[model samples]
Target: EPEVTQTPSHQVTQMGQEVILRCVPISNHLYFYWYRQILGQKVEFLVSFYNNEISEKSEIFDDQFSVERPDGSNFTLKIRSTKLEDSAMYFCASTNTRDRDTFGSGTRLTVV
Candidate 1:
């Protein structure tokens, strides 16, 4: 099985600050996505990228959030300003087909 790598297993940030989460999907994957899970809540989709452009994004991915696929290898998620409500476990996922997906361990974001 291949792996999706995410950096900074944990992140601590202050409210109103900016932060960027990084991910590297499997080399062969063509689809990449960002999802967030609150401590006790279900996973929520943030954005999806394919062919270097954003394919889809959820309402939760508002103006403050952005995704980028730079150099055809790294997939990144950036939050312009951190909020207490934005603190969660952010996961990076990738898939070559609709059958299955591979996810990274996730970055635990803590806001103060």
Candidate 2:
């Protein structure tokens, strides 16, 4: 079986600092997305990427955030400046169709 992988399982950053979360999707999947979950909240969709461009994004993906598939294999999310509210478990996911998505373990971002 294939799965998504994320690095630095945990991260801590000072308020206003920058952070980059990395993920590698399953080789055969096409749709890729970034989602997050606040400690006590439900998972929220942040952005979706396909064909090397952003296919969709939610209100949470504001100007301060950006995502890139710098190389064909790795997808990255860069938060230009961190805030207390940005602290959450960020998950990376991918799927070949709309039926289901495989999610990464998650990169827990903590803003202090």
Compared with the true structure, what per-residue lDDT tens digits does model 2 show for residues 29-48? 99999999999999999999
Question: Where is the poorest 10-residue window by lDDT in model 2?
Answer: 94-103
Q: Name the top lDDT candidate.
A: 2
| Candidate 1 ranges beyond 4 A from true positions | none
**Any residue pairs clashing in model 1, and if so which?**
none
Candidate 2: list runs displaced more than 4 Å.
none
CA-lDDT, candidates in order = 0.94, 0.95
| Model 2 whole-model lDDT (C-alpha atoms) | 0.95
| Model 1, span 8-112: residue lDDT tens | 899999999999999999999999999999999999999998888999999999999998886788999999889999999999999988559999999999999
